[model samples]
Target: MTEDTSWVGPAMQQRVPWVKAVGITFGDVTARRVVAHLPDDPQLHNHVGGPHAAMIFGLGETASGAVGLAAFGSVMDRATPLVVSSEIAYHRLARGPLTAVAELTRPAEEVLAELAGGQRPEFTVTVGISDTDARETTRMVVRWTLRPNR
Candidate 1:
């Protein structure tokens, strides 16, 4: 199914208010990939003056949800998508603006087929966070499940 990801940012803002409250921005959202950004603000800085780890984690999680929505929007009538778990690791001290790129670990079509077979399909999205200089600063993996509606 083709999803118009242009609605991702706005929809996220409405459904997950914290994302917008934290000043996260979105770019190029597709079924398999979604990109999000977090501005470097003093209020969001950690002890060392870098973006706080929690904010960076939020950026990655939001990006994962964006891609998941893009991939599964058409099937929402029958299933409710939820995050099962997530793991994030900071690779370097993040400075300046940060960007997160999330991609599905498996093809959307395949996962959809599993749902069609009356199975609750679980998939993982891998997100890579980078600094303005294009240096990798963090990595995250979010596992999601599309629970069939009762």
Candidate 2:
């Protein structure tokens, strides 16, 4: 299967403007990169006037999901794809525009290819989100078990 052009990074950014409204976007993909951000927002504060953890999670989740979805199209049938699991960790408080970047470091893609050959295989994609200052506020590892059908 070929990649799903519709879910490309730019399109997702445009469609899901809400995320962009919150100031989160995808970063470098050829290799590991950090999430870039501006100063923190006081509006989304958690009493302490600092960025809320939920906001951080929201940013990380959407970014991770996009990477997985894009990769799914890259490897599987774009018609019907599979939904998998995602794991993430909050390393610190975020107070700026963030960058979420991901990479399929392992040979799991090979496993996914094998599984896609039969009953649809489950695979994982590791994603990381950090601030532009080179500080990492979140680390995530998302698994997407995909197939042509379900």
Candidate 3:
């Protein structure tokens, strides 16, 4: 069955104002993965003129959220997805426009099955931030939880 992922865009737009403030733009979005881009703007640069660390991190996080919403959106009525934790590492200096690719680390069906059995389910999304040249500059793993509504 095709997944109704039409909610991804509006979810990102309405839920995360901070991402918009940073000028992050989303690309391909699916149940398993998401891609986003951040333009290299002087206002977003760090002292060394690269995208600031926080802006890069936000780009990755937003990509992860887009995929998460695509994967678990059907269950929104019974559960609310929340980011439980995240770990990120900056690997190199990022320059020019940057891209972030995020993918779900666990099968959506598996997580949904656990939730159906009356347990909160947690899953991870891994994101890679790369420069215009396609060299990875940061890596992030964000853990998300689908908490059952009380």
- Residues 13-64, candidate 3: write the lDDT tens digits: 7778887777777788889999889888899999998999989888988999
Clash number by candidate, in order: 0, 5, 0
- lDDT by residue (1-150, candidate 2, tens digit) is 533344455655686776677765444433122232323667766765556777766666665556555555455453344447667787776555566666654454675566656755655556566664657778877665555554
Instruction: Using TM-score, rank the candidates from best to worst.
Output: 1, 3, 2
Lowest lDDT sum, 10 consecutive residues, model 3, at 2-11
Residue 55 local lDDT, model 1: 91
Where model 3 places Cα greater than 4 Å from the true spot, the runs are none
Q: Candidate 2: what lDDT? A: 0.57
Q: Sort the predicted structures by lDDT, highest score first.
A: 1, 3, 2
For residue 145, give model 3's deviation from the true position in Å.
Answer: 0.6
Q: Could you estimate the TM-score for every candidate? A: 0.95, 0.66, 0.94
Best by TM-score: 1
Relative to the true structure, candidate 2 reaches a TM of 0.66
